[model samples]
Target: MGFPDDTPPGLAGVLATLRGDVEPSSLWATLVDLAIRGVASVHCCKGALLSGGKEYLLRWNESSSLAPWEQEAIALLEGKRKGTEREVSLLSLFQTLAFGSKGYRKALEGSLEGAGLWSRERESQRKRVLLISLLLLFLGLAAFVVGLIGADAWLGLPGARAAVAALLAGAGVGAMVLFLPYLLVGALSSSLTDQGYRRGLQWRAAAKALKEELKGEGFNVERWGGDRFPAYSIALNLTDAFQEAVKKGKITAAPPWFSTALADKAEVVQFGALIALMTASSTGSAAGVGGGGCSAAGGGSGGAG
Candidate 1:
């Protein structure tokens, strides 16, 4: 199924949050979603981050009415409680993201959940997975012990049964081994309601379709348009794939919401990497701290006040 018609502004961001990783990529994806909605334009500039390296910059459009998350992002980037801005560096932008990252996510989650589109409780999700894993481990261990002690054999079927008990033991051991990995992944995973899980499958299918298109001959950009699908890719966490796909084409059809100076796929990938790096420094020193929990995701000290 397609994303709903009453889609909120940060659709990608919301979907990304449903993913539960909370990495900078989620924030990056949201930025792209906002840009596609006319909230900002993104591009790479040489002096944007460090003096020598490249980084992303967002140019906000004052005319576009803002989403709450969008407003918070801009306010954090500009270092103001409230106001509007024309441009902001992504280094500072990401830092702003890191500051209230949890608050930001919770806000989005609450809104989405209230609307019946979400049902992931992070801590509970981990706990539920952990409990299932422990139960499986206990069962496996019990089975192993019973098999080793000849309990199954004791519950005797005579000679041929001994071999059968051995098979049961092997099955238990396999269950233990298989479930061990499942436990670990699940523990680290975000839980999804049955509805959320189904929705996620749809998102995954969409991403797979986009990837197939990227690999096909004479890749068509017009069929997908510029901003919308790319925004979905970012939201889908296919950033690297989409960026690599761009490198294959001389993408001149830059969306007006993105930086127009971008000449080819390399620049597109350039900005993509910078967005990919958003999660890297999110835990940096909170040096420029002010009251109101303002801090950087990685470096800059900017937050709500």
Candidate 2:
């Protein structure tokens, strides 16, 4: 049940290793190291999260499976119960640096803006549709009332009451036909807006959390004055040097479980399969069967786990 000889360690493997019974502090340290590696990778690929040291918030705009890994790592660190002050501080530092990277920030801002615009548009459309539907409904009711008032007077005229009743019935049906579609549209628009608003809030919170964490870490954060992406840039520190080392291969990027011995072969396989399932569930990818379970750990060991 051991991983195949060709199988390489990946984020899933690192996570599996961390899932072992390790001390909380050790786990947090490993996570921090991994976060550093991730940030370093991004720095090497793209420039810093700022332009001209003052203008534009550079964010990661690329799509990769690695994005989820960073988030999961942060969540894991946050969930630790007996975490040390150092661990918490390092975790916040990692999040601030990793999430504040150019590519990551770009993606987050893009998502936030898109969701915000969509929500606002849908909300406005919903309101318009609802107003129109309500107006039609009121008009229909008024027509019905008018018909009833005329019915008593027309009753004395031959066939006049019947004609008025027919006209009112047609008007009511026509109004309903017009109202139902608009009602449905309004409901759909409302739902879209609700979903978009939620997504926007989540992204905004992530950005804000990163900003606050940087401040807590004693980094000099300043608002960019240049006409570019509205982002706060921070003073460079140890993270910049560490990223340089990572790029130069002076610092070996190790998996979270580098020190931990491999688990029982059967357990390893089971864990690999479980990771595969989880990854598939998150990414909507098809779960591979049997030996394909090892695919979860197929990528070379690097970056954040």
Winner by TM-score: 1
Clashing pairs in 2: 58-102, 59-102, 59-103, 59-105, 59-106, 60-102, 60-103, 60-104, 60-105, 61-103
Candidate lDDT values, in order? 0.54, 0.33
Residue-level lDDT tens digits of model 1 in 1-305: 23333344354444534443444455555666666676666655434222333444556555347656556555554563234435565556545666556645666566556655566575467878889998998898788777766754456566666776677688789889988997887765654555654655665665566677667665555454344656555555665555656567534344555442334444455444543454343444222211222122222111111
In terms of lDDT, the poorest run of 10 residues in model 2 is: 227-236
TM-score of each: 0.58, 0.26
RMSD of each: 9.7, 20.5
lDDT of 2 by residue, 1-305 (tens): 11111111121121122111111222222233343334311111111233111110111112244443344444444443132221222222323333223333233323333534233354456678888888898888777767766765576688667688658856876787778788776654432334444433443343344344444333222221111101111110123222332334433433222211123333223322222232232223322321111111233223322
Residue 107 of model 1 has an lDDT of 62
User: Where does candidate 2 stray beyond 4 Å?
Assistant: 1-118, 159-162, 191-305
lDDT of 2: 0.33
Residue 170's lDDT within candidate 1 is 83
